[model samples]
Target: MLDFFRQFISFIPPALVPLALLAIALLLVAPLGLFAFNFLAIKTLFEELRKIFQDIFKLIIPKKWDSAKTLIWLSVFSWAMSLPTRSFVQSFIAFCGWLLLIPGIHWLMHEEKKIKEFLTIEKILIAPWITGALICFFLFATPESLPGIMVISWPIVSAIIAALPKFIKSGPAYKVPDPPVRQDLIIMVLFNLLLSCWIQLCYSTQVWLAQYPSFQADDLTNSSFVVKTPSNESAVSQGFDILRQAETALKDSLQGQSWSQVERWLLNFDDRIRDLNEQIIDRLPPKAENAYWQVEGRVLPGEYNVQLFAVWKGPSSDNLGYHLAKTCQISQGVPVDRTPWQTLSPVGSASPNTQVDTATVSCEPVTKRIKGQPDMAQ
Candidate 1:
């Protein structure tokens, strides 16, 4: 079932995913828009929403008088509905946002007992759940700064918002308190707007990085056989000579062999080359630590391709290593007639059968630092 949902989301364009998340964030905070327009209308809006939800859930769970609790549950319901549709990181941020609201809801519920007229609509509308959604959007937008922002700013801001009423009471109480004109409400709205801008910045950074990553040149070089060494001509020449010698020896040894015989002969030849490589590395200078050579070859009917890789620790103070690869190919050997003389006696053949014996050789060189080795020149 989860896989089916994932497949459905996969059909949506990659660029649309983040936009959809942003849309959801805006939708979650749509109540803030209403609160900004007229605080009284928010109360009416929530009253209607509460009644609708109570009717819908009446069949499952009995409706209670705790509207604040119901609003909190509805926030959780929003998170649950969005979680499965979003990516793992987005889902995690949404979950954290939900977690951040629990304390705020508990504080509001506790404060309702002390205050003579608890502003239920005002408190519920600007709850930590809404702020958490804004924070989640910021986190998804700017993943690099997520930990710092969440750890440093989140708790401090939440605490101030939770203790806002007490701070206001310590000053002077208006005959009729205006929630919108409150200092904490103003700060919260400004902070949320700033966070929205931060989200935009993060999204832009992500797009830039995706288009031009830090190590693009290095990635390209690694993908191809281009050599970085100062001198690759000598290595390439040597590889060609070595491949020519191997091909000459092989042709002489397996001139008239069948396909099975040819395969066995090539296997033995490979083993001999392996032993030779070990011997060659052993003769290298003592400074060449972790020195090794690798020889690989492929044989076609009348063609052969070979590659030799050489790697050794450099004599640099940092214990860096050097690596080089040379590939060579021999192709289109002349084919010779191998049928016995008596087989052609009935026809009294006068023409001597043609054979292909010639083979061509070519080599190319590549160089890079050995794995786990530092860059010596750098």
Candidate 2:
């Protein structure tokens, strides 16, 4: 069969052949699938299957099998089939499994209703099951698994389903309004739109939180939404790790350098930090922007103080934003009385002179909640 399909498609252009094959495949499957669904949906077959299952387990299955039970069973089976497999065949089978529910629901809705009496309570009873089945199918087939068009279609489909009940006529003689301009449907649609906006807002907020995790440290008390805020320690953990790594790099690079070399390196602190940022910035989340690390050095009486700050400009309680701080003190292993140049003999001389002392570095605990925004220029 595979060889025949390949030979049959060999006549078409390479670019169009895949599409042609897909069209052919669909054409072949559609009729068979329709027939299978119609056969399974026959009232006698459905009842017989239900009766066999219930009779075999009558002791454990006390309730009579109904539409709800059937829908629930189908949902569970579909989920189970999709959960453990990633193969194309298994995924297709799972897709077919959920589609079975559509025919089942359609059969139930038309089982006891006349064409004009669809607006009756009995017909309306199946609406929730349909809505639920759609929701479950979407949840089972996530955005990543589905095509872009399918993902975009879900919200519109959901809105249409929500408004379907409004079209249900209350009685046989009651006519739908001319032009169909009903206030209830208009309000329902507007509410659906508002609900969509709220959902989008929540998703955007989650993206912000992920990119700028430091925002989780903010005092959300004044905010209207009651969200579960992460602990201060957890929120700043990434910032602290960045600072600590930079401190270690600085110590390793300047460990054995002369005092003058140390001073010169600190003088180009901004350049060194920029290069270091380029090295480690890829570790951050893709959407993280305007977030970086800065290091500054101060020459004390006998020691060098280097303060590392992980600064990020993002949504926070204060619009100014926040930074995490870590201070490290670098000192000479032994007190140096002379410079590296002086410690060496004259250029022409062969005499060995006193050894030049190197700097030793140690950092303190990382601090959180330091106010003020970082200077982007520096």
Candidate 3:
């Protein structure tokens, strides 16, 4: 068994060895820690911590006023004061929010006392469950401070909201009637589990949107419940920008050249297209696999046309996936006298009437979806 452990440890990456060892140590220590929690020394330490909290609370609050009432009123006052500014309000709200939970739980426990004495309710005072729940609520309420982690906070907040009432009602001290477990308590537990799963699924949809932004551009008429449709500015508009840049490059490099020279440039156009792709990749965020701009060019009489396709290789209802496309047209610019006519001639000799036309490019608006895979480059 020791040799087997050694062999397993060797398979772990060098950087992860310490983490793996720490995890193993935690697994071994957790049961021992739980068993030791009921020891007299541990109880003494907890009692001391409780005294420290009480002392701190007394120092901050005046003895003349009720502590819970004062804290609640002050929190309300601070909230009203913060409404107009909307700046640094989240931090103040978070601080007061968690503090409010102390009185909140106290009120709940006090109300439950009116019914019957529950020994289990007293145990909750020593435990940190309420503290953890309040922290989750604070995180969920103040999204601006930690937006990325808000999704994780939702399920914790939901579970606590669903179970707290039931937890307060079903104390172990309550005598069991005809049924050992109350039907309502069982139903609440099952309902809370389903609610947590639903919350998780909602967050997962948001993750999918982040991975495939084009989905945001799709019809959200039926998906309003799952995802709020953003503004037109946030839609899949990268295809238009990519085509615009490619059109600019075509005009900058191939403009003012004769038809013959332009033909020669087209022969090696694939290299130019490849360079454009490299430049685009460097400028934009890393796209999903096979989801990049693919440009296909066509040569027309005295003109060149190219199609820019924004390919998507991510989750889609369609098997072939989808793409956005825009077409760019390149035409000749006004004629200009060739430098060769003036430079090559003698100083006294008259220059010939030789001129070369330059090229210009214009692109059309992006089509929503081209439906099929992009055509091979010409």
Candidate 4:
């Protein structure tokens, strides 16, 4: 397919460069794939969508049972193309397995119905494994899997085409046909391929949506500090060792003064985070997708959201002890002994959707839930 594109781009007259470029961009990056070339058409809307999806999913999930041969071919082709690397063998095997896996599933189930009328794990395993082994040893032993996969899909595609009328006879929800292979099986394949490409587009768009706002929060970057000490090292170097080193000096300077130890530590910590943020510049969101930070609530109507400023202030500054002593704005601050403000997410910080507005994590608790590490807080 990529080869075809490479050839296609070379054939266009120089005057038609813009049109060709447009087509290429749409083919590779549009929300829907190169829609025109696919030539997929369906009379029924719902069935069309179903068949289309089954086809589309092949990109992410192979359609092995759709054709054992195609699966093997695909595996071998992929293996070969991935030269300058040797791991393609495993991938080829897996692709072939998946190609046969699902269809093999349905086939064994159909066979079981003819006999026991019910399925057992053993009954399901035999034929698919046998088919997969045969495909690997006989066909995919070479690197023709790319076109091989296309060829392999034909018989399965043909079978699907033949069975189409029967599948729909049962009606929409009752038993929609698996593959929507038509006389133009190539068209169907292309259609599904386009849909898969659309999915990739949406995935990329989603990531952009999530990341753009953070990037825009350039001014907010200063909200987290990156202090460079006279030592020419980040204040954050060696896990707050810099803070600890400054602690004794601070304590000496505060001789007979009444500031609390934890408060002093937090002050220095806050300064550090602030300095980090100062080091980074701020940016605005791109017009393509307007970005903002938002949080969610788990209550009945989960739409309850809290939008935070792009540039954020750390929770440690808003820690119960500090907020109580200095701000006095949040009168009923969280209890000191209770859980700290943290996120349950992988990063251990809350998104705007979370209930916990601020986070405090403790690594030394006896009954810690996160193994030896502290739970993340927001």
- Model 3 error, position 337 (Å): 1.8
lDDT of 4 by residue, 106-162 (tens): 444344444333333553323333333444444434564343443333334434443
* TM-score of every model versus the real structure: 0.23, 0.56, 0.53, 0.18
Where is the poorest 10-residue window by lDDT in model 3? Answer: 123-132
Where does candidate 1 have its weakest 10-residue lDDT segment?
A: 211-220
Please provide, for model 1 over 117-227, each residue's C-alpha lDDT reduced to its tens digit, 9 standing for 90 to 100. 453464453454435445544554464555434433454454455445544564476243377556665676577557655655556544643432311212224434333
Tens-place lDDT digits, model 3, residues 102-157: 56454444444432255246433312344435556565555546454454454445
Flag clash pairs in model 2: none
Error of 2 at 26 (Å): 75
Pairs that clash in candidate 1: 334-356, 334-357, 334-358, 335-355, 335-356, 336-355
Q: Evaluate model 2: give its lDDT.
A: 0.64
Q: What tens-digit string does per-residue lDDT give for candidate 2 at 1-378?
A: 999977877878899987987998999999999998898789778899999888877533325466534664675678687878888967786767767666555545544345226635653343543554465464555755653333334455566776664566766345464455577567656765676666667767767778666566666678887465444434443566677777778788788778778888877877887776665555655556435443433333446887667765555677776777777787777744555566567777644554567777888988866767654444
Cα TM-score of candidate 1: 0.23
The runs of at least 3 residues in candidate 4 whose Cα sits more than 4 Å from the true structure, single-residue gaps closed, are 1-103, 109-183, 214-378
Ranking by TM-score: 2, 3, 1, 4
Candidate 1 segments exceeding 4 Å error: 1-265, 268-270, 282-303, 313-320, 336-359, 366-378
| Backbone clash count, each prediction separately | 6, 0, 2, 34
